[model samples]
Target: MASWVILVGRISDVDHSATPHKIITNRDYLAHPALFRGQRPNVINLSNNYGYQSRGYYASLLASSRGHRVIPTVETMIDLSERKLYENALPELEQALNRCRKELGGEIPSRLTVFFGIAPSKASDRFARLLFDWFRAPALEVAIRDEKGWASIRKIGFLPLARMSEAEKERFVACLGTYTSREWRDSRTRTQARYSFATLVDPNEELPPSAISSLRHWARVAEKMGVEVEPITKKDLARLANYDALFIRETTAISNHTYRFARRAQQEGMPVIDDPLSMIRCTNKVYLNELMTLNKVPVPPTVMIAGPADLEIAAQTLGFPLVLKIPDSSFSRGVKKASSPAELKALATQWLADSDLLIAQKFLPTEYDWRIGVLGGEPLFSVHYLMAKKHWQIVNHERGGKPVEGGFKSFTLAGTPQHVIDVAVRAARCIGDGLYGVDLKETAEGVYVIEVNDNPNLDHGCEDAGEKDVVWQRLTQWFIDRLERQGR
Candidate 1:
């Protein structure tokens, strides 16, 4: 875990002085990184140094550059701090201004929202936007501009302060008050953090190996690197804000709890995996095919099956041994290999009922399909999933439609063919830098992208086999790097 350092110009706050953290003078904080040690500590700026003009500003800029998580991040300071604080509550301020304008007979100059670092020489102070979130404004300042270029300022009287719950008040107070609460400490770090992993587990369903031994291994490796790891469940949504970052271990879907968690975590400014957009883009094959074809990525000859007539066009265009798949199908669940018109009709008729459209592809048979795991825009690992015995797909699920995966072979990143890696990166790039699995088929003619999936499996021994614990460590490392970019 990262350490804590309190920065103050004076030790006047007795409650703050009691913390065991190392203390540094505000002047020393403004000094460059070369003057300090290398560890990145979490800092509390008690000097109340704020704004672009303050020494505390330079200190924060320097601290963040050195990887420290300084409170009142430059972003928070610029976007939500003093002087500009009232502007942060633009909606309420605008409403107050409009009300003043209406009271003054529709004159635009009748009202305004203003801020000053010092006590105002005119008008009056009526509202305060607290440093912590949850905004409110009760009144406004009226600016009366006459034919002369000069203007006179008078108060329009702010609205009554918005009533806040006990929790909101306490949260606001604790955030700006003396002692940092244990809960806040758990969720955010003044320094580097031992992050949280959001995952789902169900006994009735089969999960990848990463859920077990790989998960345990992640914790072990995290500890070795001075990082913390915790596995959380879907029920922990309310508690998610207490963690440093979110890594979704469950399969992601745009409409599911996983998407909700990612969206919420993102709103709170925490780094997240399988970000909401990635889930939406990667989960739907229709979207993926369109994206790939538009970006000029090589894909099997494909057509959309939106109407009954298109099925005939597909048959004529793609011919026998073609494949038909539902847009959101996974694990070979809604995929079918059609060898005849009757089979295509039965499958397309049944599948089209569930989705508005389907995909038809030229079937490209191979001994196995390559699964390239790409992370942070680079290829991390590769696996070859051999087709199941007497089955056309890697996962044989035709019997009762239950998925049955087959044997897999993992290879080091360096050992995989360059063309495979290059094409994999190209496909993954169509999506963002989020973790992805690019499935491809390597044939004598060339390589063709099968699909790009977010939240690709990181099975303990399989995906990580290429580099041992390095794969998991690299994953956690990305989280750590991204977490540093968030919050103060």
Candidate 2:
């Protein structure tokens, strides 16, 4: 797929001669890029007049929500639209100054802030030359009324003055006066970040180097990409400010420091992996089930065993030989298969001791489950994870399970079944366009999503076994693209 522009309205009217790029009109298909669709990430720049009536607003919003890069982003369009509707001019000239001051945080006396929501289209004309004699200086206590003495409330409609003549500059300055207000941000507190990247790794909880040489391999990749990567331990919570972006490599829990790091990094305007929203949505099976079901993503025959009474309902709905899961368990832990009523009761009682709910799913016995590693809504690598020998699950974490091992066979995206690819991508998009490992089961019934895991395993030897180099490159490049787009 080539670079596409979403020219929603009047594609014929749009003169695309200025840039040599493919334009997707209302008639063209907006493709969710396939794995074979080359290197460039799918992008859409919305080129349409945005207002309440224009389809551009909805298009921009949807594109942005799905993590597409949109020009004149949804927020910008709304800001401009609101300017035409909800604006108050403070007596006269460049009336948006007050809003800028507000955006900068209340009032600032020392530092001046100006905003250009929509840049001046045309040039400032001779109308700007006329200025009152009293407005020549920063008049702090002038009347709210203009020189005419009538009530003054002028709209902000100015043109760019980057190439103004000396005479025009003087007149322009005289037309606008400054005012004194309290400082919005302190000068001393604002400092440039010291490092380019900070990987949030818990010494005890990070993926093992055997499964993933992340510390050394990713650091090397970062180096090759000209990114300065540093390991930030749990103790470096305050030092989050020192880095431009964060990558949490630890097991994230909503109640733990990992989630806090993700939240804080997002708040500080850094591109983060396992983004806070993803962490919140993917951490709980209950949330994933509802989200997927609501969105029509194929999920297994499942029921929420929320209370003691629901156990019978689950038994009736799913019948015998079903799986029970605690909402937020990892590494095949807290997941149990109950073949009988007694086993189901025992497992439910054990899991319910912690979480308020349990996820009871009909056991879909298969040789191997499909694990699709989707990043940015496209498959990076996929694997068929086989059950352990003589075990019911890929990983047996039971008290005396056979030496804790899981088998996997990697495959290129093209070699995988289309249903697997389609369902995985569909399931992933329902969750955000972040790095996700969508685990799914392919059965005689249909392809059913097991669960969507955020911060999916990027084990160097396993997940990356197919397109070894591409897997690592894709992950690192995602950060690079995010940082560059953010202008970090």
On lDDT, the leading prediction is 1
TM-score against native, each model: 0.61, 0.60
Clashing pairs in 2: 107-182, 108-182
Q: Write the per-residue lDDT of candidate 2 for residues 1-488, one digit (tens) a residue.
A: 23344343446533356345455642232223222133332333333344532345444433433344444443334323433321311323334333333444443223121211111111221112111110111111111223332323333221223334455444433332111111111111122343488887766653331232555686777788788888888878777888988877787775567776775676466778888768766876766776687567989888877568888988999998999998777767778889988998888987776665679998998888899999988889989889977888887666473446678899888789998999999989888878898999888889999989887777766777787778877877887787676555
- Cα deviation at 460, candidate 1, in Å, is 1.7
Candidate 2: lDDT of 425? 94
**What local distance difference test score does each model get?**
0.64, 0.60
TM-score of 2: 0.60
Candidate 1 vs. truth: CA RMSD? 19.5
RMSD of each candidate relative to the true structure: 19.5, 16.2
C-alpha lDDT of residue 108 in model 1: 48
